[model samples]
Target: MASATFRATDAEIANPERGMYVWAADDLAAWTQAQADAQFAAGYRIVYTPVRLDRYAGEALPRKQLDALNESFATARRAGLKLIPRFIYNYPGGETGYQAAQDAPLERVLGHIGQLTPVLKENADVIAYLQAGFVGAWGEWHTSSNNLTLPAARTRIRDALLAALPADRFLQLRYPPYLMAWALQAPRWRDGSGASRIGVHNDCFLASSTDVGTYSEDAATRRRERDYVAALSAVAPFGGETCNPADAVDPTPRGDCDDILREGRQFGLTYLNDTYYRKLFHTRWEAQGCLADVKRLMGYRFELKALRHSPAVAAGQSGDLTLTLRNSGWARAFNPRGVHMLLKHRFTGAVVRITVASIDPRSWLPGTTSESSARFAVPAGTLTGAYDVLLALPDGAGSLAGDVRYSVRPANADDAVRAQGWDGMLGAFRTGTTLNVL
Candidate 1:
């Protein structure tokens, strides 16, 4: 029989690697900091920035622009936030559509990615994912003056960007057909193991039957694309925004929250734009009192079902710890995060962390439970006292490893734990269960 030490019920609170995103460029310093801080305070951890390359379609991004972009990344890092970055050549013209005047040549777009590779690589830690955005207005890859949709140009651009990014970072395409075509040509994409590291994003999600052309107009093609997106999201990140309610042509659904939940689970969505058409969401769902559910289920909400271990241990001793966790959110964590068990002094607050190398939290899919066990080594010390065992999910990267801003909190309704701020991190929850070290 196992001796359980800690148990918890699921609760709603903001975690990391998922949430509503702030839409703006990182280089917009004044707007970036204010938005990032406000969003962070409100329990959001992701920001979507469209890095406009429209101004210099014919030339390299100016030095000033590059510096500004780097500064924006630094700001996000400081604020302990992640950004979903897209590089676009043109903004959508409200009525005219497809303003080709500012569109960059295919070659220029590829060159720009190569030039920006250094910055992207340097700050890859803060990027949630890169949306392939060099073509088309609003970077949706349609109605473009440039013929980037042509197979050859598209392939070359995709290859260049893929080569520029590190293997870990994911890139998102606008359409599923585009990726399906590419997959047919490359066996890696067909492997369905996320080797291609590419996924799709639906900007005008759930607007119309065709979702504003996110999928094919034909019924069969739409089904195929939907399946493709579902398959891709099993291992890759997939998400987007709800389109403006006023523009939705579909009358039957009428922003049904149930439909949203159904499709969200079906598609394995990892994130969404919270601000766009948000008023409609508030008006429709808030009064009905289901918006809180939507917020909790958006990305990955992990709960600790049970934790068991030896109730007592000698100083410098090694012992076994086991944890059973359930993922209640809509999707899995699409990025890497560290899982460690912390042994903290009750009085002095000194801590010793044992990282579990065998457990990868990214594989914790929704509606599923998983068990993990690992041996923890307690440090040799002179003082013998009771210790608080805490669980920490911090960024694996060394720079952010010590920053509690990057640590993830569990969705348990323990106000004492929530208020106690885990390990020196202010406003950060470090989940705990008690243990004694003699």
Candidate 2:
């Protein structure tokens, strides 16, 4: 057995930036510095908001709206919050106000997508994920006045959106059947390249027997939906909102904390709407005093249990680097993250980074301890000195490549290792271990 070295870290329960997200709408004013700072202070790291295109269904998005969106992204970045953006042209009961001439035509909708692609790619650093919207009322991909639900139309729009996004980010479809259909059309989706990035989102989660029609009414079909979602969620990101107050089980909160927690684990939920279902989380769940726990397990919470490695290493050589990490939160990091071992000179401020591709953060499921072993090597020409070992999980691309805001915070009580930058960037976390290079 290898020698064990324990890092000085306490298991405190108030780690932020993972659990709950505040819901924000399209208004640029709402995402101001004050508002976002308030959220950050409350331990929130994400904001769920919609980019409504109801006004620009036929033409390009007005300059005013686009500018507001850019401002919102900037505000979010300043406040150290990631954004979950959904682009929609309709809302609940949108059919009543839907007009054929003014309603966006298929061609115009595709045009809008083309227009939005640049903005998305530019801000990919701060985006958590994009919901496959641009169809149906409320962007749920259902109950639409336009023929967006048609197989051809839906496929065309979906393909365009997929092609438009940056390769690192994944898109979530509202329904499972639609995903199946898209997969069938694209054969290359079978190899986990495409399928691994596509996910599911159910707006009416746990609202009724069929989750308010999120799943199939038929027992057999429902089982298939569950199985399909489970498979996709294993590798991809999945999450959504609780049911509306008008749902069938409304006014009484459908299930207790146990039921909700069990189902969340079963579904592999990565995020949920904290602004909605106020009664369920505030009253029903809070009365039982499980609200904090529910928030704790909402998304991915990784804790560094212990790390073991060779005490002495040689320059220009390889050695075993082992890490014992645990996912104490409810879900995993649903996006592509890069794991690296960073070595910084104790006195000289020299730095060397070794990428570890073997550790895929997506596979780190909740309630499971993962052992990661990598053969780390120091470069050919290095000064003989003591160096600090650090761990960095960064987006690897975009403006926030080295920005600590996109990195994961290990839930440990070690102040030095877990400290963030003055601007709230995680930069890179220390490993509490040092190696001598000779």
Instruction: Highest TM-score: give the candidate number.
Output: 1
> What lDDT does model 1 reach?
0.74
| Residue 36 miss distance in model 1 (angstroms) | 2.2
* Per-residue lDDT of candidate 1, residues 1-438 (tens digit): 124333344456667668666675432434467767877887778888878777788898888888988999998887778888888776765635555435678878888988899988888888888888888777777766778879998888888777777777788888888888867532333243334588778886776677766778788988888887877777677888877634444423336677677788877778888876665553576777777777788788887777777777787887787878888888888777888877677898877676777777876778899898877766677257766667788876777777888877776555463332344453233445566877
What lDDT score belongs to each candidate, Candidate 1 first?
0.74, 0.70
Candidate 1 segments whose C-alpha is farther than 4 A from its true place = 1-11, 25-30, 99-101, 184-196, 245-254, 279-282, 312-317, 380-384, 415-432, 436-438
Q: What's the count of clashing pairs in each model shown?
A: 0, 3
Please give, for residues 130-217, the per-residue lDDT of candidate 2 as tens digits: 8887777677787667778899998888878877788767788888888876664322322556655678887777666667777777
Question: What's the CA error at residue 350 for candidate 1, in Å?
Answer: 1.6
Report clash pairs, candidate 1.
none
Q: Give the clash total for candidate 1.
A: 0
Write out the backbone clash pairs for model 2.
Answer: 90-138, 404-426, 404-427
